[model samples]
Target: MSEPGSDHDAPQAGREPIFMLPPVVTALAGIMLAIHLATTLVLDNVGLYQLTLWFGFIPMRLLAPDQLPGGFWPLLWTPFSHAFLHANWEHVIFNTLWLAIFATPVARRYGALPTLVIFLVTSAAGALAFAATTLPNVQVLIGASGGVAGLTGAAMRFIFQPVMVGTDPDTGQRVLLGRHLASLREVFTNPRSRNFSLIWIVLNAAVPLVPALIGQDIQIAWQAHLGGFVIGLLLPPLFERSWQHE
Candidate 1:
């Protein structure tokens, strides 16, 4: 039954499937796995360390430009490159799962090309955000969490609302038959969105504490997550407003 006064009460009725995994997403995730295997399993320790040093986002390198082997050029690429690197298998698995969950909808909406752009921008933004919080040389950021977090943010734009499809009155073609884009005010005002955001923020912020409690030495890059999420949230309005009527 429809929840009280929910507009999305109408059951989904259309030829277009609501959700499906795009090959792009699967291929991207597979590439990440392949890279992990190549770096960790195929390469020797020295090679892996070299790869990490070259690709990982080292705050120290940015903070101390003179110390950088190739100078500022590496800084330009490290932000996005770091997304393809993970510290361990657990890290890659965690990030890949989240990527699958959040990125699928976005890739569906924007297709592969724009989705790739989103990944790069959010990944870089996350790295930059993390770097801002820490002192130079303190940590080398690596992982797809930032990019995945961005996808999560983008999905929030329309995923929660019910989407309807129908023929356009003028064009006689299928058009957006769903709720309009949620305004910024609406996003904050809506209980579901507000609560989800709150829970997500709190959980990520609390991750660092989990290691301490569990007696593990692993570091959680919560800073990167927050940064990427923020980028994801903001990016859609600019690029995806057009898709609202699609």
Candidate 2:
């Protein structure tokens, strides 16, 4: 039987096995960082403002689609496009770092095309979830947090298993997916998985309250994080066939 992540699980009988970041994963992270720099450093305040207005996911627009500036057509792109933009250097940097960790495994297992698909779908799902919970004219949601959260969810599919030095009966050596991959029950029952889930939930749950303690009026898109994470957790199984061959 084929195991998930088998493609990257073991090295072939080659001269040497070199470990490195897959090119596509690196490229995706590079593109996000490059865009952040270009928008923050190169673009003028007015230019950057305009881009945000155009690209940012505004829940109000969904309520009043006819009132959107530059026509309602921009709505078509904003859902996924907003992920490519960030509010500040810290926001972009943090998300990019997470992407490197989670997306690398996915890209290695499923290839570049599927990784891109995951980014788009999770980004949009997160935005939609944010819109669903928020009232109109609240605030615009920006950043790759949702997409990265989705990646985190995807990684949870098999990354938490016990590791082995050599081939073990339960899980082979260096195999993240393990012998049979994890069922939802195995995932939730595992201590590491349970703790991570709790921590993630608490962190997102506290997003709105955290800003208040600092006397800031920021609206954190916690809804998006939850949405993306749920999608990530559930999406991997459906796409299992794509990576099973690896």
Candidate 3:
């Protein structure tokens, strides 16, 4: 039988083991950060504005295909393209850090291909939520935060699962078998994990509310975050069987 965590079936010989980041996720985050920085520096406000107009996914405005130049492709691609645009350095930096931290573990757990699929699916869901809730005339919805939020939600699912324990037949020693949802619930219900989850929820829920409380026009896109998180939370059980088979 193959080792549980082994990447391939090759014999454990003299060859150096491959040590590499998950390719699809690393590439996606790197490319997004690069584009955000490059565009911020290269384009003037007017140019940047125009770029956002063309590439950003604004659900309400996007409903009218005739308003945009490229039409259907823009709508399809916008789900990904919006992830490359940002309001400013602070926005990109925060989102990039979050993506790097949360997504790496998920990519490692699920492998690069499944990670990418989850990201795209959750991102599209986030965008659709944003479009559905807001006014139709809103010009552009930009940033990778939605996708990152999805990754966060997915991470929560991956982390919060049950574990199996058994006893050795001969030695009569306890052994941890594997993790599953029941074990996760036990962990989460404990004070530490429950506190952490509460803190996370409070902070994210406050993100949009704080801006509004300050009487600022800046929108935090909380709806997208919530949408992505819910989708990710629900997706794990559906995908779990296949993931275990892999």
lDDT of all predictions, in order shown? 0.81, 0.80, 0.72
Greater-TM-score candidate between 1 and 2: 1
lDDT of 2 by residue, 1-246 (tens): 546557644544333634477787788778889999888788898998789889998888867766667666777999999998988888888888889899887776677887787888899999999988887655788888888888878777767866533354675555444333467778789898778977997899788787669887765689989899889877777667866666
Q: Please give, for residues 51-165, the per-residue lDDT of candidate 3 as tens digits.
A: 8877888665456776666765678788777877888888888887788887887776677777777777888887887877786556467877777777777777646555668
Tens digit of lDDT per residue, candidate 1, span 1-246? 667546674444324654357877887798898899888768888888788778888888866767756667788789999999987899899888888998998888877877888888999988988888887546889999998998888777777766677797899998766544566566667788767877888998888788779898668889999999888888876766556545
RMSD of each: 8.5, 7.3, 6.1
On TM-score, the leading prediction is 1
In model 1, which regions exceed 4 Å deviation?
Answer: 1-20, 164-167, 170-179, 208-217, 241-246
> Number of the top candidate by lDDT?
1
Ranking by TM-score: 1, 2, 3
lDDT accuracy of residue 30 in candidate 1: 87
Cα deviation of 172, candidate 2, in Å? 15
Among all windows of 10 consecutive residues in model 3, the one with the lowest summed lDDT is: 178-187
